[model samples]
Target chain A: MSETLTIFTYDWVPKGPRGFVRDLRLRWAAEEAGLAYEIGAVPFEDRQPSHFAHQPFGQVPFLTEGDISIFESGACLLHLAKKSEILMPRTPRGEAETTEWVIAALNSIEMVSVPWWFLGLSGDHENGLSGWLDSRLAHVETVLGGREWLVEGRFTVADLLMADVLRIPQVRARGDRPASEAYIRRALARPAFEKARADQMAHFAAADAKRGEG
Target chain B: MSETLTIFTYDWVPKGPRGFVRDLRLRWAAEEAGLAYEIGAVPFEDRQPSHFAHQPFGQVPFLTEGDISIFESGACLLHLAKKSEILMPRTPRGEAETTEWVIAALNSIEMVSVPWWFLGLSGDHENGLSGWLDSRLAHVETVLGGREWLVEGRFTVADLLMADVLRIPQVRARGDRPASEAYIRRALARPAFEKARADQMAHFAAADAKRGEG
Candidate 1:
C-alpha cells in the first residue's frame, strides 16, 4: 500500500483487468487497501506474450508490485485480500468462507459456464453444452435467486468475479429475464459498480477514437 | 479425528474423481491427517436429481463431515486440512502459496485441458480450445519441468490438487518425455494415491463383472 503500483492491462478499452469488473475488483481492493496505483494498458494481441509470460494462461489483469507478479484473477484478488483487510475479513472463518466462494466461482460456476459460453460466442456451440448451460443457469439462479450476492453482508471479490463471468453475452442469453439476468443488472447498478463501468467505458472510447483516426 | 466419517463417492476409480483425482485428494489428506473414513460409491447415472440434490452440479465426490456437507474438491481437501497439520502447512504464507497452485491447477492447467481431453475421449473437438490447451501445457511443462512436487519440501494439498488435475491424459500427454511421465509416476506412487486408484478400479471392475455375470 505504500508503493506506486503498476496494473498492466489491455490497450484501447478494458480487456481483463482494465474492464470495470476486473478493474473494479482490483480498484475496490486497492481503494479498500488504500493503495494508489497507475494503469498501464497492453495491446490485445500483445497480451499473450506480454501478459502470458507473467500469466501461465494468455489472459489480462496481471499485476506487478515491484518484482512480485501475480495472475489468476482469484489469486490476484486474494493477494489484495492478504495485503488489505477490507476485501477479505480479518477472521479465520471469514477468510475461509471467502475462499470457499472464490473457488466456487472458478471451479463450480464460471469454469464450466465460461467454456460453454465462450464456445458459443466463438460460434461453435456444442449440443451437450447447450443443455448443460441451461442446467447451469438454473442452478445459478436457484443459488443466487434470493441472495443479493454470492455471500452475505457486503460485495466481496466473489461478486466481482461472478458478475463479470455472468455478464458475457453468452451467459446472459441463458436466463432470458430470469433471475441471473436480473442479478447482473442489479449488481451493475451499484455506485462502485457504476464507477467501474464508466471507467471501462472511458477506456473503450479512447481506444475507439485512436483506431478511428488511424 | 474422533468420529467416524463418511465420504460420498462413486466406486473408486481414478478417472473423474471416483477413482482418479478428487477421491485421491481427500484420502491423501485423510492419510496425512490420520483420520479413518468409509467410502460410498453412487452410480453415475444416479448422479442426477437423486445424488445431485446432494451436489447441485450432478458431480460426484461430496463429503459429509458430521452435519456439514462440503462439495468441490479443493474445498473438501482444504476442509480436511483443518483437522491436522500434514496436507496443509501451518503458516498463512504456506497456505497462501498452496492456495495459488491449488487454484492454478483448476483455472490454468486443468481448466482447458480437461475439456480438450474429454473431447478426445468423447469424440467431439472444436472451438480452438485444443490450441489453447497446447499452449498451456507448454507453460506447465516449464513450471514443472525440474520439480518433483509443487511447493516447499514434502508434498502438500497443492500437490494433491495439482496432481489430480495434471493426471488427465491430455495434460500428461503434454510431457512426452521420460522426465514428465516420471514426475507423474512419483506423484502416483504415494500409498494413499495407490489406494485411491485401486478403489476406483474396483468400482469399475465391479460394474464390469456384474455386466459379464448378468
Candidate 2:
C-alpha cells in the first residue's frame, strides 16, 4: 500500500486561530480527493529547528508524502490537486485556469487581506491597507458575480483556496459582497470542508484536554 | 509553426516603476526557457474591460499561448517552467521543491515585503509591518545562507521569483543580509534577467517616444 500522506501543523494554537489554521487547507484538499492522510504536530509555543527545516518561516501545514516534503499551503494544495482529477481537472486548460486562480488567491487577495487583517489586530480596524483590500475584494466580487466556479465550471483546488481566503472573518465582515459571500457559502457547504474544520477543531481540543490532564 | 506566446502589459508606466513591472518576470522566465514570445500592450492611462477579463485585478503580465490564457506572474512562471528543463527539472522531487519555493517566494516573502513597501510609500519609512517583514527576511537569509539555489542546488523558476521579490529596492534596503544579497546578485547576473529587463525598458521607452510624437 502507498504510504499515507502526513500533514504537519502546530500541536496547539490559541483559541483565536483554531479553526483557521492552514493545515485545514491540506486536510480539506485530501478529503475532497478522498485521500487518506495523517496529521503530525510540532510545538506551537516552542518551535524546534526541525520545524524550521520543514517550513522556513516556521509556519505550519507542510505535507510529507513518501520521500518528498512540501511547504507552503498553496504548494501543498497544488501537489494534492495533481493526485486527483476531482481536485483539479486533467486537461491543460482546466489545470491552467486552476493554477491561475490559485495563485490569484495567494498573491492578489491574501497579499492585501492578511496584512490588512494583521494591522487591524492592534485595534486599528481601518488600517493603511483598507482601501487596497477593499479594491481587491471588489475585483474578486466582480469575478465571482460572473461565474459559479473559478475554473472549468466545477469545484477545483482554485475554488478551495479562493474560498478559504474569502472566509477569513475580518475579510468577510469588511463589506457586503453578495457574490463573493455566495461563493464562500457554496464552498463551505461542501462535506470536505466540513470534515476538515471539524477534524482541526477536534485536534486542538484534544491538545487542550491533554494539557488539563497533565 | 506554433504561435509564439504573448505577454500582456501596460503600454507605458511612470519612470519610478519602469523596471519593476511584473511582466519582467514572465519575460525573464521565457528568456530562460528559450521560448519565443511577443509583448502586447494595453493602455496604461485607461484600463479596458477586456484587460480586467484577462486579469481580474487588471494587473499586467498575463500570458497567452495558443488558446490558453494564464494570468498572475507566479502562474505564468509555472506555465513557462513546464516547457523547459532549463527552468525546472522534470523529476517529481525537483519539481516539488521548485513549486514549493516558487509559492514561498510569492505567498510567503512577497506577501510580507510588498505590503511593507506599499505602507512605506507615503514616507512612513517603518510602518506596522516592519517587524514582520524583518523577521520574514531574516528567515529567508537563514535559508539562503545554507544554499546556493532554492531547489536541487540549481537555478530554477523558484530562484527567479525569489530573486525578483528580493530585488525590490525597499525590501533590499531593509537590512544587511549578506546571503540574500549574494543570492540576488547571482540571480541578476543571469543573461536572461538582463535581456528581460532591457526589453521591458525599451518597450516602455518606445511608448514614451510615441506619446511625444503624438
Candidate 3:
C-alpha cells in the first residue's frame, strides 16, 4: 500500500466510447475504496512496445503499483479489492462469493454481451448472438430480482463490475428486464460511479483540446 | 486445507460436451496440486433449485469445500490456486502474473472464442466473429511464441485455462497459430490433464449406463 497506484489508459478515444472506457472500472474501484491514484497515458494511435510490456493485448486500463503491474480490468479490480475490505469482505466465504460473482460479470455476462454488441455493429439487430445474449440477461435479471447487490447484502467490487457490464447502452436496450434495469440505475447513481465517469469524459476532452479536435 | 474438497458437475451431459465440461478445470487443478477430492453431481436433465442456489446461472462446475461453495470455472480455479503454490506461485509478482493471465484466458480469449464457436454451430464457417477471433488467436500466438508458460516462465493454472480455451477443436482449426497449438499440445500432454479428462469422460459414461443410454 506504500507504493502509488497508477491506472494507465489511452491518451485519446472517439466520442462513441468516451465515458465507457475500461479504465473507468479501475477509477470507479479506486473511488469506492477511497484509494488515492494517478493516471498514466499511452498512445491510442500507436501502441508502443512499452505498452505491450505491461499489457500484452495492447488494451488499456492496466494498473501499476510500485513494481507490480497487472493488466485486465478484472484483475486490476481484484488487486485493488484485496487492499481494502470496503471493496471486498475479508471473510473466506464472503471473499469467495465476491470473486465468483466478479468472474461471472466478466466471463459469463460480458462474454456474451460484448460479442453481441460487436456483432450488432454490422447493422443487424437480430444477429446470431441475440438470443444467447437475451438468455444471459434474463438469467441476470432473475438474480438481481432477489438481491440489492451482487455479492454481500452491501456494495462490493462484484456489484461495481456487474453494474458496469450491464449498463452498456446496447445491452441495456436489448431486453425488458425491469429488475436488472433497476439494479443498473441503483449502481450508477452512486457518487463513486458518477465521479469516475465524469473524470473519464474530462480526460478525453482535455486530449481533444490538445489535438485541436475539441 | 483441512476441509474436504468437492468438485460439482452435472451427472450427465450430451456427447458433444461430455469431455469439455468445465468441471475438468477444477479436477485438473486438484490433480496438479495432488489434493484429495470428491466429485459431486447435480441432475443434468432437471436443474434443481439446489443447483441454482450454488450456481445462479444453473451451470455445472460449481465447487464446494466444507461449507463454502463457489461457481464459475475461473473462480474455482482461483480458489484452488490460493491453496497450493504448485498451482500459483506465492510471490507477489508471480501471483499477480498468474492471476492476470488466468483472467486473460477467461475474459480476453474465451470471452470471444466461446461465442465464436457458438455462432459457428449454425453451419456458418465465416461468421461475423471470424475476424475478431483470428485477431485474438494471433495475439495469443505472439505471446506463446516467446514463453514456455503463461506466467513466471513455468506451468500455472493460467496455462491450464488458456490451453483449455485454445484446444477447442473449432477454435484450433479456425486459424494457424503454431505457437498456440504447440502450447496446447504441451499443456494437454501433462499427466494431470490426461487424468482429469479421462475421469470426467468416465463420470459421464457411468451416468449414461445408469440411464441405459450408453
**Sort by DockQ, top down from the best:** 2, 3, 1
lDDT of each: 0.66, 0.93, 0.92
Give the interface RMSD of each candidate: 2.8, 0.5, 0.7
Better of 2 and 3 by lDDT: 2
> Residues B26-132, candidate 1, lDDT per residue (tens digit)?
77777656788877666765455667555667675677755455667776777777677678677755665666678788887766766566556666454346777
Candidate 3 lDDT for residue B126: 84
Candidate 1 vs candidate 2, TM-score winner? 2
lDDT of 1 by residue, A1-214 (tens): 4355666556764344345435556654565456677776766755556565666555556677764566667777777777765577766556655666677778876666766755666676664356656776677777676677765567676676677667876567654646777778876676666665676667667887888832
Error of 1 at A11 (Å): 4.8
Error of 3 at A56 (Å): 1.4
TM-score of chain B of each: 0.83, 0.97, 0.98
**Number of clashes found in candidate 2:** 0
**How far in Å is the alpha carbon of B170 misplaced in model 3?**
1.2
**Candidate 1: residue A178 lDDT (0-100):** 69
The digit string of per-residue lDDT tens for model 3 on B22-85 reads 9999999999999999999999889999999999888979989877999999999999999999
lDDT by residue (A1-214, candidate 2, tens digit) is: 3466999999999898988999999999999999988999999999999999899999998989888889999999999999999999998888899999999999999999999999999988788999999999999999999999999789999999999999999899988999999999999999999999999999999999999932
Extract clashing residue pairs from model 3. Answer: none
